[model samples]
Target: MKFQQVYFVVDDSFRLLWIGGEWDESALANGGSDARSNEVLSTSLLSHITDEPTRRATQAMAEAVQDTQTALRIDYRCDSPTLKRRYLMTIQPMKDNRVLFVHDLRDAQTFPVTFSQWRHQPGADALKCSFCCSVSLPDTDWTPPEVLAGPHPDVVDFTLCPDCEARITEAVSALRDGRKPGVSTTSGYGPEGTAS
Candidate 1:
């Protein structure tokens, strides 16, 4: 599907000078519109981005706004309800004023989520079980049903949300502070008089 685009000028001081695709009819008349094709762009339109690299580029821009030797490129998204917007920002030296190339990211690879949404998300390649490499979750009720019944902290006694993580960090910290494990008074026995 074809994607729409817009551009915003960033000045030497990192100020928003002018926006190219501000729902202006002039841009549409000038053939700068991405709506040439009748493709239906959904409300969940994507953003063209990579997080870490963009951060570094912005930092470089902050420090080297005056140096011709340094150049910065930032590809960011615009939060517009009317349409999806992605911009490729180029910060470089010009003879008179600092120039920012605001190219439309229509054909660029897109992510359905924005950068903020992606960062906030837990991630797909995360630790499947918080128990770590050595630990495991038992399905037995004696161990508590919360861990087995659903995704909740009640699985662990005292309701530790991330019992595995807590244990790992606590173990390391305890070793550093030279401490011993505490005893538990609660019995592990079942209704049939299993081991307590």
Candidate 2:
């Protein structure tokens, strides 16, 4: 299987400048036909991110890169209905106050059974982490969507779980403190935010 890569550049002010490397193909494959390069160019990077927590974390990461002039790396999952795809995202500071984001596919797995595509509606009872693909019911701990039994929620909210939020914060803080942050893609957090 060929692992695909996608990259985009943004000015210091977070305006989209350029995008390349399988971006259009990935978008089309991931049900993002409207996210083509022609349509997204010259827009705010935050505008493309629909999840509120995700937008905040992305802005923080970009700002941290600009402040420290250091690159930050994080691993995330962007799974489709039948495929589990892992990617490493590198946020690199560039000259002329530009930041380059490169996403490298690290792994892909085909699920034994296909899942129906989920819809994300604001204020939904079910919450899903945008980074980890974990799902949580109301007043419950996060659980991997793979292990979930039948009858998944038709509408779920996209947000970060506590563990993901902490990990992202740590990674950004390390950059701010002039330390290199390690990459973590591990999911499945327990009730207390411990890796299960």
Candidate 3:
């Protein structure tokens, strides 16, 4: 049940006080040549997040955690030239006016109950991806909905994110054109399914 994860302690002002977990120094570096852990210390945790919408959401969550003195969870996506991934972040308020942040990377698709559907469903608390086990976002192109909209969770509609939808479209087009659908060599889905 081990997944790619990272954790850090942040002051009420969102300053990163400490960081540790499964993430390596390279993964923790914020696009800097100096990937040393010491360099990451004292930096604002939100500074490492490049997405505007996600960063704003994270800020709101941090504020709420501090105000209510309770824990909160949020799902977000991050992508850079070196990495593209989704994570679930949990924020817990500490007695010392600091917040503990836990980040769990989504690596595998979990079935049975999709995270998106569970949120709107009654009595469910766990959030997870519906199909690909990747984190789910509403408006983002990289991570799209896998289920169709419906009142019944059992009959939920499944939809792929824009990137995945595009990959499927390209593969289908290749088949229609009577050629083999290319396989991507890199981690991302490239044009015509070939490596970028």
lDDT tens string, model 1, 62-133?
335345434344333332212233333344555445444444433223334322211112222222221111
As for candidate 1, its clashing pairs are 147-155
Q: Point out the higher-scoring one by lDDT: 1 or 2.
A: 2
When sorted by lDDT, best at the front, the candidate numbers are 2, 3, 1
lDDT of each: 0.32, 0.78, 0.47
The numbered model that scores best in TM-score is: 2
- Highest lDDT: give the candidate number: 2
Deviation from native of the Cα of residue 128 in model 1, angstroms = 17
lDDT for predicted candidate 1 compared with the true structure: 0.32
Q: Model 3: runs farther than 4 Å from truth?
A: 25-34, 76-86, 109-196
Off by over 4 Å in 2: 25-33, 188-196
| Per-residue alpha-carbon lDDT of candidate 3 for residues 64-123, written as tens digits (9 for 90 to 100) | 667667666544343222234455556788977898988766533443333322222222
Candidate 1: regions farther than 4 A off: 22-56, 61-66, 69-89, 106-196
TM-score of 2: 0.89
Higher-ranked by TM-score: 2 or 3: 2
